[model samples]
Target: MFEKFRKKSVVSESSQLETLREVLRRNPEDNDLAKVFPQVMPLSAVSSAWPGPIERLGDLPFGVSWALADPQNYFRYVSWDMSRKWEASGTNWRGLAMENLTELSRRYPYAGSKKGADGRPFVLSLLNEDSMGPSRLLVPGLFQDLFGDDYIVAIPERTCGVAYRNGLVGEEALLANDLIDGCFKVGTEPMSNERFDPKRFWVL
Candidate 1:
């Protein structure tokens, strides 16, 4: 019975993987590279088989990777094979990715400024309706306009990123740390507990 159950599990896994591959397969026009965007994720969340290279975010354990969004199927990582093809076609994938990401940010209407218990101001985007919470961290200029200088940023959960003004003090600072720790403790697809330096991301 044990062997039978193990075999069944393996088969189920294989079927699911195949279904994902099928969903990723696209025709020429459908393979528009302009749809590609940069995604921020913890190193642990990435698998060995994940296509394309993972660019480290400065000294942080998190990394920036590329993904293409399929309106019907959500999104998929850009495969090495596809990367090569795009390069051969003289496509600057990174530039394309950034352009798409910036445009997507314009469409994200869920984020706003909020005050902590101690009346400290911060900008928070939780569970972005577009489902690109952590990715928003890449848009430093946009958030910086709202947050100004002397602020810290955190991407605790996959769908949550916050930028707190005044560096790390008062109730807002404590709240940011608590949110990061709580997300990690609860295994809520946590990204990072460490405050992200947007400068590091700019180097990419």
Candidate 2:
């Protein structure tokens, strides 16, 4: 489903340069720029690097790894799906004791009852580039426009936003995702089926 769509945008090279400048401006004293922008730029930097619809990822988790691998591969957001690793492990990964996250999404990206100390329910939402407004920018506001307050983590390149209900923040939700027994990570979001065109500013 995700593969069928194409996100079109004429990225202004100048705009990207400006965006990077703005982010670096936050900390002018840092002598080493590499320290600030690590191997995989933090989720926050991804938001800041582009001057598009989505300018920032407010409180997303740290597990996200979307950095510009090679300048030649411009406009491509390098993605490493932890879930895919499990998918490769066969039943050992997919057959976890948890719910079939993929199946739950078939109906509605809703939540279940409170399970942990935080008294929160796991919530999942999707932010799609095809459905996103004209700019193809995965803006933070887009999550609110779509799933309201239930969203947790958002993968802009994949164009999917995940959330956990109640007060369970991204960290807690991700923790629960790992700790819960018999829990299978849901394949609801479009982590796959994406191709990034190096020549273009858009990832299709």
Candidate 3:
């Protein structure tokens, strides 16, 4: 009788997990997840258990210097209006829109928009880190919402290899490199005298 009870408990738990996964898969933008599972908010729980290399402040210098020195490779022109903001911020390029994971999934379910030269499938996630943890739900949810039709679901990894075959870098490689060298420049102030001035340059 005890053995039967244990089996039933295991099945129930598995079913619950699957149900949660399905919900997240269908609704990546459900902010209510935090209410349902408060511990998953702020991403601290996931970050703590992340199985990636520890981030160090020293790494910032390399990424910052590289970006500052090579404006062409690092910067991309988004639009005339956005260029002004980028100039004001003293940055020429924008990193992948991490905050727009849900939108990206909604628009490009299989891969990123076809209008671009780089036809890579845009990666989406909630947790900013590239590691195995609870916060990892953000990525899987984004993937399911966006590319569920084309990609396979894999926990922890949160990316589908077959769906990303044409991408420039695999999800793991992107995570590893991004963790090692990527920097988030949101809401940072531009240094005095370092702001870009488009008015100073004329289009020939």
Candidate with the greatest TM-score versus the true structure: 1
Q: Write the per-residue lDDT of candidate 2 for residues 21-113, one digit (tens) a residue.
A: 555345323222111111112234344444322222323221222222122323322222323443465633222211222222333332223
**Span of 10 residues, lowest total lDDT, candidate 2:** 31-40
Mind sharing the TM-score for model 2?
A: 0.22
Task: Please give the TM-score that candidate 1 achieves against the real structure.
Answer: 0.75
Better of 1 and 2 by TM-score: 1
Better of 1 and 3 by lDDT: 1
Model 3, 8-91: lDDT tens digits are 112343464355445434532322111111011111212222221112112111001000111122211122333344558774
Q: Weakest 10 consecutive residues, lDDT, candidate 1?
A: 1-10
User: Each model's C-alpha lDDT?
Assistant: 0.64, 0.31, 0.26
**Arrange candidates by TM-score, highest first: which order?**
1, 2, 3
TM-score preference between candidates 1 and 3, better one: 1
Q: Please give the RMSD to the true structure for each candidate, in Å.
A: 7.2, 18.5, 22.6
Candidate closest to the true structure, highest lDDT: 1
lDDT of 2 at 53: 23
